[model samples]
Target: MQDRFLADVLANRHNRAILERWDDLALPDAWLVAGCLFQTVWNLQSGRPPEADIKDYDLFYFDAGDLSEAGERAVQARVDALLGDLGVCIEASNQARVHLWYESYFGHPYAPLHSSRHGIERFLVPSTCVGVRPGEVCAPYGLALLYDGVLGMNPLVPHRDLFERKAASYRARWPWLRMAADAATPHPAA
Candidate 1:
């Protein structure tokens, strides 16, 4: 499963380019994350080009020592300079600082994250929660739901309204993706 998923994500040339040059960025514990990884696989499974409908690349890094907005902007500037020519937006976020602004922006309180992986775990859909860096893939929840095109609310972030909004956006693009009604009932953590 890991090998196949790796191959699927790398099929997007921009993902490949970013991973190849990832060492150039000095951000700590950084991982290329979220929509860019899952959506590329979705696009491929739908027989569309791997890069189709990809809005931006998300890069998550943990910098607890410097949680200021300016610190995040500095990292983003570095990301832009390195990957700007790719002609796609690359958004770099400091996972450590999410708690400071999350409640105001997303209207939900987010506790401080211990690591970038912790932040990844809070994504609205477990199947869509994934991250990658050179030589590594961080998918705590396996790929079955993603491969099956199943959309379920993530237990870690079980907000009905937010999940509905997010799932609707995804289903809008890939009408074939199925939403499991029972998935909202909490189960033991995966």
Candidate 2:
């Protein structure tokens, strides 16, 4: 499943381009996460272009050595300098600093992350959680639910409001995606 998912993700030209330059990113424990990868697969499944409707590419890295907002900005600047010609939004987040602002932004306290994968594991939905770079495609919770199009709340980050919002947004875009029995019930279609 990992191989299949990875191949499907790379089928998107934008994703391919980013992974091709993984080494150039040169950040500690860095991985491209969330929407860009899983949504590519979703698009392919829906017979749409692989890169269609992808909002942004997310890049996460753990840098305990520098937790300041300025340090995170510097990393993002480097990413922009390197991949700006891709003509897409690429968000590079330093996982080490996420905890500092998570509470204010999300109305919940988030513990410090130990690695990029640790941050990836806390997505609102377990199935939607994935991270990739070069030879590595890390889906710590596996890909069964994702491939099955089932949105389930992640035990790792059990925030009902956040989960409902995220699931609703995804379902709004891809109506074929169904809620898992354990997932928060999605909002009625508007």
Candidate 3:
């Protein structure tokens, strides 16, 4: 994999601390994998002359089990406190996932963490579920690492479908989350 432009931007104190320390967390292995992929892609995209830029770090948690309100709140509070201590701004959506945005005047988490189902296979191991962004016109530095020792080219934008057979065998998860989410609310009789 190549080192992305975002790496340079996040190389600062706060982000560097968070990125380096994420592995130490006892959260599921999938969390670590997803976080790794997100960070890698963000770093790459941030450096390029972009059609878009990452404004905040988004962490999407894909869990098959339904969490209770108390459980969710506890998790969010813990994550928020950890981020606060790191001097980073953290927020969570109604879904109970954490979103870490850069607090520095010029820092941002521009890259988004999008996830989908791994199907019937045993993806419960946190290290399995990973996110992938599309390739730019010209390959970014260290992009090869994203492939993780594989010889292939992925066309999925913002995220690629690597193991389709596995994804297909099981139920479809997170089908259109990004598509349904928008900045605007419903129009009034327009």
Candidate 4:
């Protein structure tokens, strides 16, 4: 199932192009993660267009040495230049630096992480934890939730409020998605 999901992702023209550009950049432990991955699968499962409603492509890397905003900005600029022509939003973040600003940005405490995979493990929802780089796909929390059509909380460090809000938005866009009771708190779609 993982192989099939990955194959479907690779078959997406936009995903393929983004992964190619990401590989060319050669960012340390880089992976095209988040919405662009799982959302594509969701679209497939729901019989929607492959790129339907996908908001952005997330590019995550681990660069603990330089966690400053300026350093990330420079990388973001490079990524923008590389993928801007693709006509989609490409969001790049240094996972090693997320803890530095996560609390201020999301109003929640996020522990410092050791690697990119550690960052993936902390995603608000289990199904969104998948990522793909040049040669491999990584799903630290496994793909069962995604394949089973279940939306589960991250047992490692669940963020109920944020998960509820995000899940509401996802549900609004894809009504067929099911939210686990733990993450099913009602919220307006953003």
lDDT ranking, high to low: 1, 2, 4, 3
> What TM-scores do the predictions have?
0.95, 0.94, 0.36, 0.91
lDDT of 1 by residue, 1-190 (tens): 9899999999999999999998898779999998999999999989999999899999999998998999889889889999999999999999999999988998988778999998888888888878999889888777777788888888778688899999999999999999976454333245
Candidate 1 deviant stretches above 4 angstroms: 182-190
Between candidates 2 and 4, the lDDT winner? 2
Give the RMSD in angstroms, all C-alphas superposed, for model 1: 1.7
Model 3 misplaced regions, further than 4 Å: 9-12, 29-55, 92-190
| Regions of candidate 4 where Cα sits further than 4 Å from its true position | 181-190
For residues 1-190, what per-residue lDDT tens digits would candidate 2 score against the true structure? 9999999999999899998988899989999999999999999999999999998999999999999989989999999999999999999999988989999999978988888888888888888879988888888778877888989887767788998999999999889998886634232122
Better of 1 and 3 by lDDT: 1
lDDT of each: 0.88, 0.88, 0.33, 0.81
- TM-score quality measure for candidate 3: 0.36
For candidate 2, the lDDT comes to 0.88
lDDT of 3 by residue, 1-190 (tens): 2344344324444445555556444344223223334333433434532212223443334443534556556656766766667644443322222223211321322222333222101122111234322221112223333233222222221122433432332213212112212122121121
Better of 1 and 4 by lDDT: 1
Highest-scoring model, TM-score = 1
